[model samples]
Target: MDPILLTDKESSGAFWPVDGDSSLIFLGTGCSSAVPNARCLLQPSSPPCEVCMKSLSLPPEKNKNYRCNTSLLIDYCHGNRERSYILIDVGKTFREQVLRWFTYHQIPRVDSVILTHEHADAVLGLDDIRTVQPYSPTNDIEPTPVYLTQFAMESVAIKFPYLVNKNFKEGQEIRRVSQLDWRIIEGNSETPFASSGLQFIPLPVMHGEDYVCLGFLFGKRSRVAYISDVSRFPMSTEYVISKSGAGQLDLLILDTLYKNKPHNTHLCFPQTLDAVKRISPKRALLIGMTHEFDHDRDNKILAEWSEREGIWVQLAHDGLKISIDL
Candidate 1:
């Protein structure tokens, strides 16, 4: 069933049928500086950025050019008919994305969260999770579990000290904040960990020459890997994701920031294509795009490329959802 077609009441809490079908939803698919860029709109020149202009010309619901921070939601349904909503990245634009996509999909709550890195666009929405996990006077609500590397944890501690320590001044005691349970993953650990009954292997990749970021390979019957902020992949990392030349991944969600040129901290279009070929996944969805790409135009290029390579590849936009076997 298409969640998009469901009425608000029909899609509400526990409304998704317990049919054992799991799916992946793109909550946001743009890079840190999301589409409809402020600069493009604020500046007036002879030639305007077509993508940014289009974002303003259409309703957000009808506009594929409209994008927020990069994030994904995995709706994992278990054998027992229970469901788990796993969120990847709570970015700066998290609240906006949630208001639109979560409400649209009728996602009741987030069961857990996984961080790809500590970048502002990746983790700044940590506090807004309170919207999903309401506080109970009797403290019945469990804190939402968040998984991240020690490095990321350290960064979070520094950025949101109150979140880590739960220390608030007397004046702020009445303020409601997100109830979060922090779980640390060992840096660079490749061993798989379990969440919502599925296994996830952390694939460490280079975000920059010195900074290490994590991607994840997850699922049971079908494997999916997500690496939203990677610039380079180590040989070991590549071997693990590709099954050491077996190319076992069913779906690969990767970063592709610019359309043509190289980027220092992100994969450019060519680099993304190169990585897609190297990993040789059965299918690929590009993410973390910038205003440089017009969704319809760029996807046409990907279509031709995919036809030639036999491995499907296309850009993922906010609110896009695809069912997957888990």
Candidate 2:
């Protein structure tokens, strides 16, 4: 779908391809370092998205700067076609993650959005879903399902009241945009409902001081697990994750916030790698990292350390995509 065009100014050539379906694209991947500037001590020499870096030449405090939080969009499709899709998390960069991302591909719709927690960084961009919920082909109506835990609901309701549409009834439809719903990760209650196509089993991992973030296991393709903003994996977390087919994993998208001795609870790069080994997830890639990491430099170090050491490891970035034959 790459259509070549003549760019008389920059290069005389540019390709505008009709972005196909079934591609897993990275919107952003930093813990809280979404919008980095001189204040971000962590990334003294981090890489910036080409487009974003281009504007750095302009005077700061006057330029229209945009920041983003950590989030992931898993597009399930083969070749130029896609069947279903799911949004892992909607961080503060919700709007920018879309605007910044829209520059590349056009996301016409979303099946559902699964929030990891209620942190402002993770859920702030939620309100923007309004734009994606009006293209439903089912029931001749656009419906976007929001899945979250009871704890998240309590926090989100207070933050996003407009999304609640307080005036609507249970079965009523509002402009074809479906309201949010509650999902039970652990319990024995005939609650609202859940989806297996997501292949996500709950892993209550610790985050910050007293907060807990949800770690999900993407089950459709190969055994892939996603856990960001977590310190240690609970025994229950391990048990439930092992249930994703055969107590084995193919890919584990983990958090590598820090890289040293430790912090409050988040896993440093070294600690994260070790966890991957213990979990025995054949292959694991670091996520939710800061610009502090030099993708090429650090990745080489990790590759040398774990290449043939019975496990595979690598660093992730915005716009990077991976495909598993499972």
Candidate 3:
């Protein structure tokens, strides 16, 4: 089918494109420490975890059980040409994840990056973006655009001062300098933002006691909400979802770190199930999994639970892709 460009009007009557051939690829689906922990591999417990052992034994391409730090890639196309390659988080494993999934030949450039929070697992790879700067289709030699909340932006600046500083006097190679166009998102606001011709509404959700992480809702007609590291959904987020008028989403990617144990900052399986009930998405996929659960076993349980609950829910694995029709 031909890719259709979706156009919608803002409150001020300004029209923008919202429709396109969009596909979301799960670049990584593991927690901050990632799966198959080195510590776990070194010391063997009683009946060492078969999943982790197997993952270590096989190569990355052959191991479906291995995982990287959670992140996402939103690829959008208009007609025959690609429009946007929006990345969610660039964590410690960003380089390896990109090399594994995104080939140099297919996607030579990344249009933009949307940071969710300031955690090391979410923003540590900001500097590596320089690798794609030269391949930018615009050929302006300008910095690549990076969207983040005020808190996240500040945290990034503190972590990577060189990236934000335009007047660094150190003589360095052009490629070594961080080329980034920082865009700060306002606090406590659901203002819609545009990146690489795609529109996104920043849905603020709680991330433990001190952090407010931003999950994004993309596309107008068929929305896909990606909340990889959220602990709880804020009321304003629900209101925004309701106001969107779909009453349900095409896809909902949420954090499901543990099966029974709940963390102070991450959602457990039960909380993820509750979230699915609230959002009522057509399809739900759980991300940010730890090493405690094996992919095959956990997925079997999830499949059974999904059938019982009458909702389509599955565990998201690295490299999983889902196309959204808008």
Candidate 4:
């Protein structure tokens, strides 16, 4: 398949793509704190964060300064002409994101969900899933399928006991909550798993020195690897995403928390570029940005870097959608 690039104008059409093409939609593209930080707006620093100030002036749809938690939606189009919406990371801003992009894209419901970790920014919005669950004529709740690592599932069980057990008081059953069918990704992290008729290979990477988070390699012909939050990749995982590895990726979405300086739990811009160079994907988009970055300015820097390095890399913004061959 040839490299697929959809201009912003080309992607601003109807909700669904052509019958044969799959699309990757960025639901949000900011770190846990998100862009337009509250402190910047409320507290007001010496000069105020430029991005956050700009965010207040422009409409969200027109503002690249406004970003929510890092999340993605895969509109998977099968050969049978059927479509499935597979979402990654139901974060703290899930509801707002749904209200904005989901409504904009006319996505009726989510077919499945994939979790990267148990962090609040990644899982706090689990409760919002009830809104998008398929309707049941009999009034019985239809559970949404969710896949995550065993460790992540354990954390979720602890954090959301009601969601896990569902044993409520006699009259409390009337109180609606998210009904989830949790499926843990057991055994080896490198092994592949199936969800909504699509295959995904887990890429286990370090969140810090002690904690691990999952990234994924998915799709058929136009393969995409996504790692929204990661400090570093293990040697084994690095080998998998490396250019010399067995399979090459068409797109790589990675973490870029800050413009400079290293952090303990997330990749800064320079490290992100280093990883992109090693992975050698045909195209790359950096996500998980902070209020420090002006999206347009940073994206221009990325474009220049791409020209110099010959690896097409850029910053991903909320609501940006790309059509890919699958």
List TM-scores for all candidates, in order. Answer: 0.91, 0.74, 0.86, 0.92
Worst 10 residues of 3 by lDDT: 1-10
Error of 4 at 135 (Å): 4.8
Error of 2 at 49 (Å): 15
Over 4 Å off, model 2: 1-23, 38-67, 77-82, 135-141, 168-196, 242-246
| lDDT at position 33, candidate 4 | 86
Give the winner by TM-score.
Answer: 4
Give the lDDT of residue 131 in candidate 1: 82
Query: Where does candidate 1 stray beyond 4 Å?
Result: 1-20, 137-140, 167-174, 243-246
RMSD of each candidate? 5.4, 8.2, 7.6, 4.3
As for TM-score, the candidate ahead, 1 or 2, is 1
Q: Which stretches of candidate 3 lie over 4 Å from their true place?
A: 1-20, 135-140, 170-175, 187-189, 242-246
What lDDT does candidate 2 reach at residue 264? 76
Ranking by TM-score: 4, 1, 3, 2
- The local lDDT score (0 to 100) that residue 4 gets in candidate 4 is 23
The worst-scoring run of ten residues by lDDT in candidate 2 lies at: 3-12
Candidate 3, 57-94: lDDT as tens digits: 86654555788999998887755675678889999988
Question: How good is model 2 by TM-score?
Answer: 0.74
Residue 180, model 4: Cα distance from true site in angstroms: 0.9
For all candidates in order, the CA lDDT equals 0.83, 0.61, 0.75, 0.83
